[model samples]
Target chain A: MNLKAVYIHIGWFQMSVTNLIIVIGMVVLFGLALTLPFPGNSKGNKKGKGRK
Target chain B: MSIMQEKEMWTSKLRKSWQKTLPVEKLLPDTQPAYVASWIYLFGVATLASLGVIIASGIVLAFEGASWYHYSNVGHFINSMHFWSVQFFFVFMVVHLWGKFWMAAWRGRRLLTWITGAVAFVASIATAFTGYLIQTNFDSQWISYEAKDGFNSVGIGSRFNVTNFGQMILLHVAFLPIVLGVITMIHVLMVRAKGVVPPIDAFNAELGERK
Candidate 1:
């Protein structure tokens, strides 16, 4: 539908090293949150139950 | 009631009344990071909101038929939203990711959150690549042919067929979203569940003391 996309300037908006850094940063944060156990779990704080 | 049913009832009955279980302050307590950057962290939520729009548009396009966007008025707008939404999705996702990174937000814990998200970010790249091809226009065809050389040169030729609408659409609308969404949802829930790490003042202090 967007034949005009051919004319769109990709180089102007393409992902670059800075964006890569931001993306990697995001991933690292997500990885940390998902991999390591929560700090308060030892206190018997509410854990994931509604997820099921 | 059967024993199992009886047990369920007891859990519900024994469950503390919502009001009594948590004091109002704790229930509505401050969990947001105290020194979270004053500029809007709300942008991440906005990116997510755009993605939500994309999914809705994508579902409609799929229902109309895979190539339906080539024909209908509604389909064109839907495609436009998908196009624009993706642009915004990357924009805010980048910022959101940066915010999390600069805040040293992952310091205290949440490694799984970080890793799953990283995988999803890679998936998004794949999803975007597929989206470019699925456009079914001149740019799509040109991009498909052009990008194939890169894949072929890299020897990943067998895994991806950039020109195939069926393959690209399935990967974009089905496979990649499932992976990204599941990870993102889990990450957000965990953030809410565990709360953000407080500013690393203590860790910095320890380092300062050590120095």
Candidate 2:
């Protein structure tokens, strides 16, 4: 049940495989959060809505 | 009028300032702007919730003694919760930071909010580093020695010895958390006062509509 942790190394830069995955996942999540429509939010549906 | 009576009390001045800046309604709002309807807004709350979990788990670990986690199963579980919650906290916080940066959250006179949030992030890193140093293991020993050089280069090594477990634990569990909590509270209050920053386009559009 033991596994050696993998790491990515590029000359002077190094990061654990798990951490690199986490970073990539966070970036993807941020993108989705920006693009995805929020539930029950009809603000985007309304025309001429500018924070009134 | 008597001299002492004529002068306003400092407490009254403080209360007035608080009332003017952040009344109950503003501090705890029932409604938010339509633009706040985004999943990105949840990251800030997620980071807060993760901090709560970390604090709760850490309190349990503290009651059992620091090294008890290495021996007792329950202690180990609690310690694991603390560890994972910290990871989640950092992840959520970093995502929140990224989202805020893209949103230009410091816009509309909210610069203090952004500054406080950034300060909290750095303070959290220091707290986490201290937590690592107090782990009482070879990993901690290695980390301390490796970190000592950096701290020394910054002229803080004498004051903040990474190898000193007692000093590190105190900073980790007490001082850093209090500082981080204060900064976080100020950041949240500023956000509540100013409201969430609108998107750049929406903000410009609002100004255009006004004009």
Best by DockQ: 2
Per-residue lDDT tens digits for candidate 1, residues B1-211, read 5866865785655654433433353335444433343433565677679779878888887788767888988887888898778877876676667666766666667776666666767778888888888887888889999998898888786787776778888988888888878877876665554455666564667676642
Per-residue lDDT of model 2, residues B106-198, tens digit only: 988999999999999999999999888877778899999999999999899989988888889888888998998899988888888787887
lDDT scores of the candidates, listed in order: 0.68, 0.87
How good is the docking of model 2, as DockQ?
0.52
* Interface RMSD, prediction 1: 9.8
DockQ of each: 0.07, 0.52
Q: Which lDDT value does model 1 have at A15?
A: 62
- In Å, residue B98's CA in model 1 sits off its true spot by 1.5
Residue A7 lDDT in candidate 2: 86
Which ranges in model 1 have alpha carbons more than 4 Å from their true place? A1-52, B1-33, B202-211
- What would you estimate as the lDDT of candidate 2? 0.87
